[model samples]
Target chain A: MSERSPKKTDTMTEAERDAYHAEKMKKKKAARDKILATKTEERGLVIVHTGRGKGKSTAAFGMVFRAIGHGFNVGIVQFVKGKWGTGERDVLEKFPEQVTIRAMGEGFTWDTQDRQRDLAAARSAWDAAKAMIADETYKLVLLDELNICLRYDYLPLDEVVETLRNKPRDTHVIVTGRNAKDELIEIADLVTEMTEIKHPFRAGVKAQAGIEF
Target chain B: MSERSPKKTDTMTEAERDAYHAEKMKKKKAARDKILATKTEERGLVIVHTGRGKGKSTAAFGMVFRAIGHGFNVGIVQFVKGKWGTGERDVLEKFPEQVTIRAMGEGFTWDTQDRQRDLAAARSAWDAAKAMIADETYKLVLLDELNICLRYDYLPLDEVVETLRNKPRDTHVIVTGRNAKDELIEIADLVTEMTEIKHPFRAGVKAQAGIEF
Candidate 1:
């Protein structure tokens, strides 16, 4: 798609280039305008970010920043991250008026090695998640590491899908983690897989404070 | 990997669950600490976000938010997304002391249709990017949509890679866009390709505020 554009030329003067460029852009704009006219629907999305690479949660946090920028109320439920004192959490805590965060996790399953406790934690987080999604006051809800819970059947996948299917019309729900289930994917409006191209951890580089947390 | 963990069961009492969880967590912590002991290197990273999916810029902005929370000075240079008054821009502008945003794009290449203008804009943005990377005061520098410029040959790939390769040791450099150059990837400590599994645009859903902006 990028290669379709004409390459730079040294022979043309600045003024000449400007006129030619303007003409081409005009035609492109007309085509773009036609496409814009066809897009009339505006509804909240069921967004899923998954795969082996990073940024699944990071991107959702980015959406949180944008939502905060727009003065929209946001709710965050870290399903398994717990209270690691993440930088994002610290920053989010500063915006109490616009944000409501519930770090309702008791570490990973392997870390806890207790079934009832894991189920209790997942149920607690899911309850919080359902409340936030059902709440009309919030515009965005982020469920971090929800996929892992579903993958382990900590929470019923059908219940999660049903809740998302019947969410408030204008409330966006973002779920992030690796190995997202297929049923969730089928029901999602947007799904992105963050494929790992290169990773610093394999090179023995430790995670930094601001970047990783 | 999440599947390897044991599932929830109803038989265990709360006290038993706690004891088991504590014992397992202790062993897991010991193993984690041993691995962590080997990771001694700490320095700035050359991070690249590229692919055909959403959140390349969004995730970088998430990092920007985290950096800001940590009170790290940040610099942002938009190579192609000129000011249409993005939500993130509005938020970043509020923190004047910590962020320096330079929006030098002249719209999309098709919109401008001018090679010289594109080249000039790229040069200006690259100048700002290099300065931010070289400056010790800034801890993180985000070059948004820089991959598009490099893919189009608007900026010199070798020069950009060279600049990043020789950047200050403590300043993190994040370049985001689709189709990143191989040279940049070759030197980058982290690379993520955001693969598109499903997109709302395909369903004729227009971009909404606080989500797509």
Candidate 2:
């Protein structure tokens, strides 16, 4: 059997072919627009502020303000701190129902050193945070000062990633701490590196309240 | 009909009372000692370098370098940047397996007007980060520039808290950002707020490479 020559018998009128081409182009354009729209829409995000440069938490806080302005609920879980002077807490208290806050209860390691107790506190905080992840209530969750937990082996890095992965699709997480983990970067959609070439502290200036506290 | 009330018994010996008091004091002392030990010995901590001040991310990077010195894996994630123009990424590249770095695709809002696309990119980075949180392979996970996502409503906050709460008990997480939520302050084992008292940018000094990028 003669190999069926590629059938090429369709010789349409110019008008008909032009119409067909136009229709195809329209469909392609529509598809492209849809894809672009999808790509541009906000979904979920992970952010990191690191390096020697300052304003990491300030950036995070700015984002918090931004989210709140947009009417999203916020939650915060701080690890590695117990009781101390707090101005942020006072500000957050204004919107009590919209935000939930919890402390890790360890304070500064320099002051407290009960390993078992500290571990227990971290565990409890973890439990509360886990529940929040499972629930689809809040829009944002901030994990503050978590780096120290890993450095001291208070919590494992593997488990944290798993939980983050499994969180609701709309949830956004922001973590602030020195010494961020490599695994976090691999999975993060965005990462920023803050470098400090100079700091007031290096210039023999002390931390100033209301501005540097 | 000894109707009234039962008679009180106070027959403890002087020695017994002394023993009881001594024991109580001992317990109190033990508790205090335990707390001190945990503070210094447990020493689970993450530093927050934030404010209008400088050296926020630089401090974080210092921790990263220190952790690597101890033969640990590290992860770096940035929230508000679109490029890898700094040496941070270059250094991370040196240990490809040990370090992972990601950038926030939209850079800062000042530089880009495509909030929609920026949000989308932030979301993808967040999705990737979630996976890392769960993987349990990396010892450290650094979330960079996550604050912007929260501020812009690119990601929800409550969910972020949940992930931090549920992360592996052993895994360590570092969060960097500015204006961290008060809720985060409450739960953080350590909470440090960086306030910008003065900045070069405020004086119209443009961000310099190796310093502000």
- Tens digit of lDDT per residue, candidate 1, span B1-213? 123345453467767766765786689878888888888788999999999999899999999988988888998888875532467877787789999988875734556677677788888889988888889899899999899888766788879989999999988999999989888899999999999999988799998989888
Per candidate, the number of residue pairs that clash is 1, 135
Write one digit per residue (lDDT tens) for candidate 2, span A1-213: 122234222465645654554555467667655654544334455556555455556556545544554556787788757421243554455567777888876632535545556667878887778877677777778777665665455677778878887778777777776677776655555455555534333333344322233
Give the per-residue lDDT digits (tens) of candidate 2, residues B1-213. Answer: 113234222354645644554555467768766654543222223333444444445545644544454455766677767433444554455456667666655544434445456657778778777777777766667776566576555687778767777776545566666766554443344444443433333233333333333
- The Cα RMSD across the true interface for model 2 is 21.0
The best candidate in terms of TM-score: 1
Error of 2 at B152 (Å): 27
Candidates, DockQ: 0.49, 0.02
Global fold similarity of model 1 (TM-score): 0.88
| Candidate 1 local lDDT, A1-213, one digit each (tens) | 123345564567768867766777789878988888888899999999999998999999999989988999999998885433467777787789999988765745555567667778889999999999999999999998999888766799889989999999999999999999887888899999999999988789898977887
Per-model TM values vs. the true structure: 0.88, 0.43
**Distance (Å) between predicted and true CA of B147, model 1?**
0.8
Worst 10 residues of 1 chain B by lDDT: B1-10
Looking at model 2, residue A171 earns an lDDT score of: 77
DockQ winner: 1
